[model samples]
Every structure is written in structure tokens, then in C-alpha cells.
Target: MAVARSRSSAGPVGYAVGDITSLDFPDGHFDGVRCERVLQHVREPDAAIKELIRVTRPRGRVCVIDTDWSSSVANGFDHLDEDIAEFFPEDNDPAAGRAIRSRMVRAGLRHTTALPVALRFTSLTDAGVVVPFFNCGAMQSRVRAELIERFFASVERSVDRGGLLFAFTMWIGLGQVPLGSMPRNVS
Candidate 1:
């Protein structure tokens, strides 16, 4: 038998642990929506986003935070291209989730482009924690380790030159639902 996970009172207001595309709530029921690290795993992000906007009230804020896998690079690795190819066979680049913005826009959302942020690493262990998941591979752990080493070396060099400059890139997109009556058509 599986144990049911209880909802926490400290979580988001009116939040439900369910699918976004088929929300149980009525139309225009939300005042604001914040989605983080969700779209990447979604099978239909566009539809899910549409659901978000549909439920949000007029002038409501919609914020999206996603990571681009394709933009991430193995620092100081000469064969970065080949390494990346071996890493993510599905999408041969670090720009994972980058195209989500346009999809949102086409779905009638007015959102900003993905913003880049930096995550600083103090040690190889820290890099190790992220590299495995980011690389998305179990068979390619050796390659991931090599990349992590190179990343740490670069960070150390940068720190030596300027003292622990920690940064990683991520995109934060914000948009708004136009305040208007819901359309009569519910497709």
C-alpha cells in the first residue's frame, strides 16, 4: 500500500497537487501563478501554460523559471561539442527550454525572454551534485566527472583572479494575463 502525502499548510495558497492542463478549478479563479522547473518535464508545456493563463484573473502575474540545458557548457573542455553530443542525445545543445518563451507568446502570453543567472561553485563536490542530473545520464558518468573537473578548475582560476565568482545561467520569464472577460468558447 502507498502512503498518501499530506498537503502542507505552508505551501502556495490554493495550490493543488495535480495536473496543470486539466485543473479542477473554475475559470479565472487565480490571481497569480508561479511555475518553476515545471515546463521542462511537462509533455505539453504549451497547453499547460494556456491553462495557467486561463485560470488566472485579468492583470494577474504569471512568472516562469526554467533552465536551458543547451546553453550550459563544459568549461575548458576542447571537445565540448562531442562531449555534449554524447551527453544529451535527444537535444544536442544547452538551450533546453529556451523555446518555451515563443510557445507561451503564441498562446497569447506576454512574457519576457529567459533570464540568465550564475551559480557559483566552491568545490568539485558541489559540481558533482549538479553535473549528474544536468547531464541526464548514468552510463556517461565518466564524461560528467570530467566535465565537472574542468568546470571546477575554471572556477578556481576565476576565483584566484577575482575571488570566488560563482555564477550559473537560468532564465526567469514573467508575463501577465490581460484583464478581460473569458471567451465564451471553451475548447
Candidate 2:
């Protein structure tokens, strides 16, 4: 956030650290709202989406981008992937990305669209940035060190043979707030 605040030159653009599920803004405060890669980490993603819709003006756009960790796939590593898939939700909301569009519609947003983007990784170093299993150094307390080490050992071997290929889907959901006003608490 400090980096973002430093790099952004637009004076009208303001940044504040606040809760997503319960923002401090009033209704129809912003023309448009966007949330990126945040829902999957929150305790109540639907509430966050509702809050996003609540703050945007009628007919304004709201966009949410998040990862569908369930869509993760690794070439020649299906077993390991399955193990992690079950384990991921113990720590994060792995299905948040795929659920965004429907949630928006359910929250009364119109013209909702969801687009899936495949993020492919060929090297362990690059995949480690986003894929938790690939980063052994992170979340050492939450994840079993032995499992991560074993997985990375296999990944390293596969990479040495030039066969490590993994990918996951990220979804971008966009919608417009309904032109007709409804009670903010209804959604």
C-alpha cells in the first residue's frame, strides 16, 4: 500500500486501509469500485461484495478479480495438486474467484460478466510468487514442512527434466449496480 501510494501521482486518488466487509464510506460514494485478489482471503466474501456494491453509485461499475485455487493444475503432479487443493481451504478461500459472478448477480448487480484467465508457470521460482505450495518459506507454521519439502523436491526434479508445468485460473467479474435504488441493507 505504501508503494501504491508513493507511485500514484493522481492527487484525486486516495488510499485508505479499511475493512472490506464493512467499509467506512457512505452509499453511492464512488463512481466505480474494484477489488482485486482480496475476496479469497476475507472471512466473508459475500459481505465484502455487498459492501463494494453499496459504495458504488447506481449504474456504476464494480469489478472483482480473484483466484480459483480449485482450478489449479500441474503437469505430472495431480496427486500433489489434489493434496494441496484439499488443504488450501484450511487457510484460504480457494473457490472465491469462481463464486464472484453469481454473488454479484445475487446481490442485485446487473450485466454481470465473469472472465477466466489462466496463469501458467514454467519455473518454480515464478510460481512461488502466487502459488503457496511453491513457496516453502512462506506459511511454514500453517503448512507441514515435510509435505512442502517433499513437493518441492519433486517439483525441482521435474523442473530439472524440463517437465514442470502448472497453471491456475483467475476470474475477473464485472457488473453494474442496478439503476433502481434499493435499501442498502437489502443486499
Candidate 3:
């Protein structure tokens, strides 16, 4: 409701709740399409990419922004990586950010470009806003609550000891749909 109200205040903008794999829009309906942080959760990211390209007009731009969770680094946390993997699992593409550019190119988009943006946090409180594992309550059901508490405690101690660091990379991919091409099923 807030998003709808905000968009309405901005101007005329169309918004619909629909699946990415099967968009309701007609072929070449939009001049440009942008998707952010959506592919990582989808079961078939390639299909979603195809749909984004499909609805875009010829020579239109398709931009994707996603996070590469595999690139997450923490200097003070010893089991941060292992815990993240255990919580998210292999089925989730933690490296989706790095793979989006290639996926766009393979989908027949031209002039593909990828850029990486690093997000650095010097404190656990800052990282907690984005990384759920940093919040004890978020991981309480999956892992032992005491373990999560200990981890945060250790992180706090590390910060006091001047050994705190947290960084992750997010990638942006930009591509242009080829001229004179029609949308096709990507399956």
C-alpha cells in the first residue's frame, strides 16, 4: 500500500503483481526493463531473464542488479561463511550476482556490461540491517539460539579489539536487446 501510494504521488506508472518467468505484458511492450535482487530467489533465473528481454523493445536496455552472497567477507567472524551456507543452502545461488552478465549474454542480449559494487561495514549493527544471519532472532529457528548469541558476542568482542570487518559485493548487469528480434519461449 505504501509503494502504491508513493508511486501514485510520483506520476503515472503501471505496476502489476505477476510472475517473472511468465510476464503478462506483450512482446516489445517496454522500452527498458530493470530487475533487482529478484533472480537469487527464483527457481529458474534464466527464464526470468528471458522474459525481461522479451518484453523490452528492440535495442532496449535490460538492467539487472543482484548480490553475490558468496563474496561476503568478515574478518572477525570465524564461521560466518559456513553459517551462511548452512542457513541458505546450495540450491540458492549465492553467486547469482557474478553470473547475471553471462546469463544475459547467453540470452542473446548485446553489449553486455557488468559492474561490481562493494558494500563495506565496520560494525555488526550496520551489517545486521542487510544480512539476516547477523540478527540472532532470524537464525534462532534454524540454528541454536545460544550459538547465534555466542557468535554475536564474539563479533562484539572482536569489534572492541579492533578486528571488525564485513564486506560483500553486488553486481549490476546491463545489456541491450538485439534489434529486429522477436520474443521466443526460453524453455
Candidate 4:
């Protein structure tokens, strides 16, 4: 953070890294907040969302964006989806993205909305820019060696056939804090 601040041209910037489940700021401090791609790794995503609401002022907006790995697909390869899902790191929630809006609604945030976005890639080289699985070594989960070989071979075939297609859904969820309301059970 210090490195970023030093390199930045903006003046008088402040940076604080606090626990998402329990923010350090006072209640209703900010006009808007955005938590992006962080909830999937959280042990209690709901609590984190509530904390975001707690720190947002009334009529403020909170946006949460996350990826649902279960929605990942690589067409032209039969085992691609299975491989990606099975080999994905367990610490991240594969279904967390799709659930963000529903969790916000359950937290009593008004004017809730969910937007589903699909990211598509047709080549391994291009896909590697965003999806790390294409590079193989970036995988954190344990997968069978033979399966990896087969997966790569299939990918090669797909690439040769000019049919490689990879896509996954990432959700953008939004909600507005109600007038004079705090998230239930949140201070």
C-alpha cells in the first residue's frame, strides 16, 4: 500500500486495510462502498456484507462482485468443466458470486439488484490473461497427473481445431442502505 501511495500522483490519500467482517470505521461513515472479489475467500460472507452495510450511510450504495467458479466452462473439451471445478482451490467459494445479491436482500438492503456477466475466451493464450488454469502451474488443488495430461492434450486439440471456448459467470450485486436503518444484528 505504501508503494502504491508513493507511486500515485493523487494528493493526501489514505489507505487502511481492516477486517471485512468488522470494519474500523464508524457506523454510516461512507456514502458508497464496493467490495470486489473478496467474499469468495471469506469464512462468513454474510457477516462481511453486513459490515459493509454498517459502515455505509443511509441511501448509500454497496456493490459486491465475485466469481462463481462452478459456472466455468471450456467447450470442445469434455472434462474441462469437471477438471476446473475439481481442481479449483477449496478455500474459495465456487458458488459465492451468484449468492451475493440474495444475501444482500436477506440483510434487508433496499433496491437490491444482481447482474450476471459472462467472460468468454476463445484461445488459450488470450484465456491465460484472465483465467490462470490455462497455465497449469497456477492450480492450487490436487488433480490427477494423467487427468492433467489429458486435459492439456484435449486443449491442444481444441486449439488446433480453432474451437476452444471458455466462459464463466461473475456477478455484480448492488443494494442501497435504507433510510435510518442498520443491517440486522450489525452495530
Would you estimate the TM-scores of all the predictions?
Answer: 0.60, 0.85, 0.84, 0.78
- Residue 6 CA displacement from its true place in model 2, Å: 4.1
Tens digits of per-residue lDDT, candidate 4, 119-141, equal 99998988876775676775535
C-alpha-based local distance difference test score of model 1: 0.59
lDDT of 3: 0.85
| Poorest lDDT segment (10 consecutive residues) of candidate 3 | 82-91
Evaluate all candidate structures by whole-model CA lDDT and list the values in order.
Answer: 0.59, 0.83, 0.85, 0.84
Ranking by lDDT: 3, 4, 2, 1
Write candidate 2's Cα lDDT for 1-187 as tens digits: 9999889997677889998988888999999998998988887787888899999999999999999977887884434654465455564687789999999998889999999999999988898898766777664645666666677778888988899999889999999999877427433
Mark the 10 consecutive residues where model 2 has the least summed lDDT. 77-86
Instruction: Using lDDT, give the best candidate's number.
Output: 3
- Ten residues in sequence with the least summed lDDT for candidate 1: 1-10
Candidate 1's displacement at residue 142, Å, is 16
Q: Each model's number of backbone clashes? A: 16, 0, 0, 0
Poorly placed runs, candidate 2 (over 4 Å): 6-12, 77-79, 82-92, 182-187
Cα TM-score of candidate 2: 0.85
